[model samples]
Target: MSTDNTSLHLEKVVPEAEDFLPILGTDFVELYVGNAKQAAYYYQHAWGFQPVAYAGLETGKKDSVSYVLQQGKIRVVLTSPLEKDGEINAHINKHGDGVKFVALWVDDARKSYEETTKRGAKSYVEPYELEDENGKAVISGIHTYGETIHLFVERGEYEGPFLPGYRVYDTKAKSPDTGLKFIDHMVGNVGWNEMNKWVEFYGKVMGFAQLVSFDDKDISTDYTALMSKVMSNGNGRIKFPINEPAEGKKKSQIEEYIDFYNGAGVQHIALATDNIIETVTQLRDRGVEFLYVPETYYDDLLDRVGEIDEDLEPLKELGVLVDRDDEGYLLQIFTKPVLDRPTMFFEIIQRKGAQSFGKGNFKALFEAIEREQDLRGTLN
Candidate 1:
């Protein structure tokens, strides 16, 4: 249960992050998928995401279709191509239903784009305004790791369901909320020796500070290893952890992701929950598969993380792992890859007070992942 407490969690004041990009929160994450209609159904029924907005032929969109879903503070846009060949189709053909944009909520999209582009960020889209009867919304974008883009969204003047060009999506079917809150963090997997390059990109191009870092020694199993560094923007609303494959006996998860994804891309997203025990239970009941954690890992749980509020029986039953930090302990669990490819997944987390990631559970967690990789014959 013991970990390199000092190095695993950076103990610094929040103000250490620069204020150049004052992010309010995550606006929305847009994913280019093979089928937006079916994907939207899966999200609604399986993940408890309610339909928010829709844009397609009905809304005068000829090339592509998009469906926006939201649960609590988390918003995800599932988009698909209508024509045979286009940018969205090319993205889906290459990446196989992966994230395209990690949009950030900001006050001024124009200023955010200018600041980052001036600081070396390549522009994906210049500042533009989308207006409708509801009001007007301004947005801009910049390229990040791989083909992923970071979009700055300014919605102070808009009152529509989502952005302009989208109509309020109404559905007769109901999907209950799972108590999932905001996005805790999103993880990206890079090519060999590319971790530091993206780490420096966030620091120099976007004014983010390194929150914590882990080498192979900190996050390694018997067969695989990877390096990761967490980056955070000012006000601590946005966090991204960049990971790269380290030397190991077998292929690490980062390497596997890059192999299947064809390049650097988002590997997983961590979603915060107020009550993980209940949320995980609901997700399981709705047919969500999670990684298998052996019961032996919980034998010394109390001695390792000390006393906690939750009953250990339920946590053990749900295969949830616990870890402690200077502030407090947290509970977390990872779901199996939701897509056909073993690339993107989700992490359910509930933090009482701990700001750190689950460092103490890295070994057990990675071992569980290795077991899955073995089943998929990707462990070699």
Candidate 2:
């Protein structure tokens, strides 16, 4: 874990403006699952992700099953265990369905781990080297809230398709690329009154500073309410939004997450794409189900946001939402809750140049989510 002093140093460096944030790009997202094979197939067929690598019993790995999938520059790894009672099983059982690892690219894994750990971060995995015919890869991990973790990856020293024993599958059956090129942000839900604790934890331990904050008033509906705060690393390569439930007439999304997941953990991963219409169309045709908004909502989009560069007809046809900022404009859409637990889902985002989250679409988006909540009988 990073120490308090390191947190102070980071606070001094990060600027309030978005332009000052330094983030290279996403590395890979790894999820702990109950069944890696089935999950991988669902992602490939439904979300347009292509199978890239695999590891398990066949590869002499006895404890776990891992499958790697890619679409454009985005890579996701799904991991499950061969047996029960292990850490993987424990994590799945406790968190229901959530991300286990957010791998970050770094020039040196050992140094990153040491620097962060010495500063006060909780050590999940010590820096270790793994080698095979493909060469060597160094990795280390640090614990975060619930079962989620951040892994430091130093792959410059290694030359491999993914890791040892995995051969790249060159298949022409690619899922049409959804304009998404990389991860934009990952949101997590925590328990009531725990928002500030996590904010401080991320700030103190991981060299992250609070970027934005929203209370119940900013993200509340007639039936539900929740508070949120966004945290970013020095290079903005990592963005985590922490949410907590607030008093409401009915169960807030954050409360529902706690109930289904059995605790706080990841809520959704927002992925950035270049063309949302094309990507969402491919995903829908491939079997991915997205959250639906009412057609009436689109009736006033043009007047609300003025004239956007893209034709509004295509976006409305695909159920996409648009939001603009002084910097630029962006198109976005969300998937229906993917897991049985209503724990983790995904966001498909296309940013023309804007860096802010889709604030303008919050009302329509929340209304869409409320529609789902009503269907699931989770709405109060």
TM-score of each: 0.96, 0.90
The candidate 1 region of ten consecutive residues with least summed lDDT is: 1-10
Tell me the spans in candidate 1 whose CA falls farther than 4 Å from its real position: 1-13
Model 2 deviation from the true structure expressed as Cα RMSD, one decimal place? 5.0
Error of 1 at 340 (Å): 0.7
**Number of the top lDDT candidate:** 1
Tens digit per residue, CA lDDT, model 2, 114-152: 877886779999999888887887888888777678888
lDDT of 1 at 302: 99
lDDT of 1 by residue, 261-344 (tens): 999999999999999999999999999999999999889999999999999999999999999999999999999999989999
lDDT of 1: 0.91
Candidate of highest TM-score = 1
Cα-based lDDT for every prediction: 0.91, 0.78
In model 1, the Cα lDDT at residue 265 comes to 94
